[model samples]
Target: MKDYYEGESAVFPLFLVTSSDGAAWSRAMAWLFPTLLLQALLIVSFLHLIWDWFQKQSFNKQMFVLVWMRTVLGGLAAISPSVGSLEGMVFMISEVTLSIHMYVLFEIFLQSIVQAGIFLWLAKRFLILQRK
Candidate 1:
């Protein structure tokens, strides 16, 4: 038989071996490592924030509310779309995750804001402000 890739006179190989997948794996690793690091850092940072809030006796409730909506709920939303096989849902979750991640990155700014409706500050020992 003739191979379509070559002229009709060319014969196809008895066994085909290709390096395309090797190239693809290399490309995948290029981004995969960095993505893993980023995801780990994001998880750590958000976990630290939640831990801080839990330990704190005083903070802006409104700030926490906004943060909760953006980080916690957004994280949940991101997770929800991923477990399903709906078309385009992963893309949508990715977009949402990207936006929420940005917000989470700037959470300290939210932390600095004044709570509008109600403020909670009932600490006695000491307050620790983590700076990134």
Candidate 2:
């Protein structure tokens, strides 16, 4: 393989942003595409699994809430930028599909870490209400 430390290769979007010096950008591009593809695949696969689960299981409030949240998060992710540049103007470099995949993963991660307690409390309340 050719050395990735060479030139300012074009990003997929072609006009999002390019490094003037070609140092950090070059390294990032080397690993960026493949990683993005893998990430997309994983996200899509997980979404498909969730869909399948929905199809097989009987409908319930808890499942409904979980699936609804996932759907909304996935929708947000679908519009996410794989990488953005703030140099002068905002630009998105990643494809929509890849962007969404990555965003979903990130959103879920943040939700888990940042709102774990709140989510647990809400889930408990929801369960209690559902029992009545």
- Full-model lDDT for every candidate: 0.42, 0.47
lDDT for model 2 comes to 0.47
Instruction: State the lDDT of candidate 2 residue by residue for 1-132, as single tens digits.
Output: 011112444333243334544775798699899996786567446646765554465435435445445444433433543331122113443332344445445566565444434544564687699999
Model 1 C-alpha lDDT per residue in residues 28-88, reported as the tens digit of each score: 6688889967865674476568766554534455456545554444443444433121222
Highest lDDT: which candidate? 2
TM-score of each: 0.30, 0.28
Per-structure clash totals for the candidates: 1, 1
Residue 13, model 1: lDDT of 21
Alpha-carbon lDDT of model 1: 0.42
RMSD of each: 16.6, 13.4
